[model samples]
Target: KKTVTFFLVVLLAVSLFTQNDMVSAEIKPKERSVGKKCLEITCTMTYTTQQCSTHCIQMGYATGDCLPKEAAKPQPPEYCCCYFEK
Candidate 1:
Protein backbone atom coordinates (compact mmCIF):
# COMPACT_ATOMS: atom_id res chain seq x y z
CA LYS A 1 0.00 0.00 0.00
CA LYS A 2 2.81 2.41 0.89
CA THR A 3 4.63 1.68 -2.38
CA VAL A 4 1.46 2.27 -4.38
CA THR A 5 0.91 5.61 -2.67
CA PHE A 6 4.49 6.70 -3.38
CA PHE A 7 4.17 5.79 -7.03
CA LEU A 8 0.91 7.69 -7.35
CA VAL A 9 2.44 10.77 -5.70
CA VAL A 10 5.37 10.76 -8.08
CA LEU A 11 3.09 10.30 -11.05
CA LEU A 12 0.89 13.19 -9.93
CA ALA A 13 3.86 15.50 -9.48
CA VAL A 14 5.24 14.67 -12.87
CA SER A 15 1.87 15.17 -14.49
CA LEU A 16 1.43 18.56 -12.83
CA PHE A 17 4.82 19.77 -13.98
CA THR A 18 4.25 18.55 -17.51
CA GLN A 19 0.81 20.19 -17.64
CA ASN A 20 2.30 23.51 -16.60
CA ASP A 21 4.97 23.24 -19.24
CA MET A 22 2.40 22.47 -21.91
CA VAL A 23 0.30 25.46 -20.92
CA SER A 24 3.29 27.75 -21.07
CA ALA A 25 4.40 26.31 -24.37
CA GLU A 26 0.96 26.92 -25.84
CA ILE A 27 0.99 30.53 -24.65
CA LYS A 28 4.50 31.36 -25.82
CA PRO A 29 3.79 31.05 -29.53
CA LYS A 30 0.87 33.48 -29.34
CA GLU A 31 2.98 35.95 -27.38
CA ARG A 32 5.81 35.68 -29.89
CA SER A 33 3.48 36.10 -32.87
CA VAL A 34 1.87 39.22 -31.43
CA GLY A 35 5.24 40.65 -30.48
CA LYS A 36 6.50 40.13 -34.00
CA LYS A 37 3.45 41.66 -35.69
CA CYS A 38 2.51 44.58 -33.46
CA LEU A 39 4.12 47.85 -32.46
CA GLU A 40 2.57 50.29 -29.95
CA ILE A 41 2.94 53.99 -30.45
CA THR A 42 1.72 56.73 -28.18
CA CYS A 43 -1.10 58.75 -29.69
CA THR A 44 -3.94 61.09 -28.81
CA MET A 45 -7.68 60.40 -29.07
CA THR A 46 -7.83 62.38 -32.29
CA TYR A 47 -5.60 59.94 -34.12
CA THR A 48 -7.51 58.33 -36.99
CA THR A 49 -7.32 54.81 -38.38
CA GLN A 50 -6.26 56.05 -41.81
CA GLN A 51 -3.48 58.12 -40.30
CA CYS A 52 -2.35 55.20 -38.20
CA SER A 53 -2.34 52.87 -41.20
CA THR A 54 -0.44 55.42 -43.27
CA HIS A 55 2.16 55.89 -40.58
CA CYS A 56 2.58 52.16 -40.20
CA ILE A 57 2.93 51.74 -43.93
CA GLN A 58 5.63 54.39 -43.98
CA MET A 59 7.35 52.50 -41.17
CA GLY A 60 7.04 49.23 -43.19
CA TYR A 61 4.11 47.60 -41.40
CA ALA A 62 1.18 46.15 -43.34
CA THR A 63 -1.56 47.98 -41.41
CA GLY A 64 -2.43 49.79 -38.18
CA ASP A 65 -5.15 51.19 -35.97
CA CYS A 66 -5.64 53.59 -33.10
CA LEU A 67 -6.52 51.27 -30.27
CA PRO A 68 -6.99 51.62 -26.55
CA LYS A 69 -4.02 51.00 -24.30
CA GLU A 70 -3.77 47.45 -23.02
CA ALA A 71 -4.43 46.85 -19.30
CA ALA A 72 -5.00 50.53 -18.79
CA LYS A 73 -7.69 52.46 -16.95
CA PRO A 74 -11.08 53.01 -18.49
CA GLN A 75 -11.01 55.68 -21.19
CA PRO A 76 -7.26 55.70 -21.48
CA PRO A 77 -5.39 57.44 -24.27
CA GLU A 78 -5.24 55.59 -27.57
CA TYR A 79 -2.18 54.00 -29.08
CA CYS A 80 -1.28 53.60 -32.73
CA CYS A 81 -0.90 49.84 -32.95
CA CYS A 82 0.73 48.65 -36.14
CA TYR A 83 0.58 45.12 -37.51
CA PHE A 84 3.01 43.47 -39.90
CA GLU A 85 3.67 40.15 -41.52
CA LYS A 86 6.52 38.01 -40.30
Candidate 2:
Protein backbone atom coordinates (compact mmCIF):
# COMPACT_ATOMS: atom_id res chain seq x y z
CA LYS A 1 0.00 0.00 0.00
CA LYS A 2 2.83 2.43 0.88
CA THR A 3 4.58 1.78 -2.47
CA VAL A 4 1.36 2.52 -4.36
CA THR A 5 0.93 5.80 -2.45
CA PHE A 6 4.53 6.86 -3.28
CA PHE A 7 4.02 6.15 -6.99
CA LEU A 8 0.75 8.10 -7.11
CA VAL A 9 2.38 11.13 -5.47
CA VAL A 10 5.24 11.09 -7.95
CA LEU A 11 2.85 10.79 -10.90
CA LEU A 12 0.80 13.76 -9.69
CA ALA A 13 3.90 15.91 -9.26
CA VAL A 14 5.14 15.11 -12.77
CA SER A 15 1.73 15.89 -14.28
CA LEU A 16 1.58 19.27 -12.53
CA PHE A 17 5.07 20.24 -13.79
CA THR A 18 4.21 19.27 -17.37
CA GLN A 19 1.01 21.30 -17.31
CA ASN A 20 2.93 24.36 -16.04
CA ASP A 21 5.43 24.09 -18.87
CA MET A 22 2.64 23.88 -21.46
CA VAL A 23 1.03 27.00 -20.03
CA SER A 24 4.32 28.91 -20.19
CA ALA A 25 4.83 27.91 -23.80
CA GLU A 26 1.41 29.26 -24.72
CA ILE A 27 2.24 32.59 -23.03
CA LYS A 28 5.45 33.13 -25.01
CA PRO A 29 5.58 36.21 -27.28
CA LYS A 30 4.70 35.79 -30.97
CA GLU A 31 7.23 36.67 -33.70
CA ARG A 32 6.49 39.94 -35.52
CA SER A 33 6.96 40.18 -39.30
CA VAL A 34 9.51 42.92 -40.12
CA GLY A 35 9.33 45.32 -43.14
CA LYS A 36 5.64 44.63 -43.59
CA LYS A 37 3.63 47.11 -45.73
CA CYS A 38 1.67 50.03 -44.29
CA LEU A 39 -1.92 50.61 -45.50
CA GLU A 40 -3.10 53.82 -43.83
CA ILE A 41 -1.73 57.24 -44.79
CA THR A 42 -2.51 58.65 -41.34
CA CYS A 43 -0.55 55.82 -39.82
CA THR A 44 2.61 57.38 -41.25
CA MET A 45 2.17 60.46 -39.06
CA THR A 46 1.21 58.25 -36.16
CA TYR A 47 4.63 56.54 -36.44
CA THR A 48 3.34 53.09 -35.58
CA THR A 49 5.64 50.40 -36.97
CA GLN A 50 2.85 48.09 -38.10
CA GLN A 51 0.79 50.87 -39.71
CA CYS A 52 3.75 52.25 -41.61
CA SER A 53 4.58 48.78 -42.85
CA THR A 54 1.06 48.18 -44.19
CA HIS A 55 1.08 51.57 -45.99
CA CYS A 56 4.32 50.68 -47.73
CA ILE A 57 2.79 47.47 -49.08
CA GLN A 58 -0.34 49.26 -50.36
CA MET A 59 1.75 51.93 -52.07
CA GLY A 60 3.86 49.24 -53.70
CA TYR A 61 0.74 47.57 -55.09
CA ALA A 62 -0.89 50.76 -56.40
CA THR A 63 2.22 52.28 -58.01
CA GLY A 64 3.51 49.03 -59.37
CA ASP A 65 1.85 50.03 -62.65
CA CYS A 66 4.07 53.10 -63.13
CA LEU A 67 7.40 52.00 -61.70
CA PRO A 68 9.63 49.04 -62.43
CA LYS A 69 10.24 46.28 -59.85
CA GLU A 70 12.54 48.31 -57.54
CA ALA A 71 11.75 51.94 -58.44
CA ALA A 72 8.82 52.72 -56.12
CA LYS A 73 10.02 54.27 -52.88
CA PRO A 74 7.79 54.26 -49.79
CA GLN A 75 8.61 57.81 -48.78
CA PRO A 76 6.72 59.19 -45.79
CA PRO A 77 5.80 62.87 -46.23
CA GLU A 78 7.69 65.64 -44.45
CA TYR A 79 4.43 66.67 -42.75
CA CYS A 80 4.43 63.31 -41.01
CA CYS A 81 7.58 64.28 -39.20
CA CYS A 82 6.09 67.69 -38.42
CA TYR A 83 3.13 66.03 -36.74
CA PHE A 84 5.40 64.27 -34.25
CA GLU A 85 7.74 67.21 -33.63
CA LYS A 86 5.24 68.90 -31.32
**Model 2 residue 58 distance off true place after TM-score fit, in angstroms:** 12
Give the Å error, residue 55, model 2: 13
Error of 2 at 44 (Å): 17
Which segments of candidate 2 are over 4 A away from where they belong?
37-86
Please write out the lDDT profile of model 1 over residues 1-86, one tens digit for every residue. Answer: 99999999999999999999999998775433433233466665565778888998898877887766664563556677787655
Question: For model 2, how many clashes?
Answer: 9
Q: How close to the true structure is residue 6 of candidate 1, measured as C-alpha lDDT? A: 100
Q: Report the CA-based lDDT of candidate 2 relative to the real structure.
A: 0.45
In candidate 1 the C-alpha lDDT for residue 64 amounts to 84
Number of the predicted model whose lDDT against the real structure is largest: 1
How well does candidate 1 match the true structure in TM-score terms?
0.44
lDDT of 2 by residue, 1-86 (tens): 99999999999999999999999999998875433222223433355544444444455432211111222664434211111111
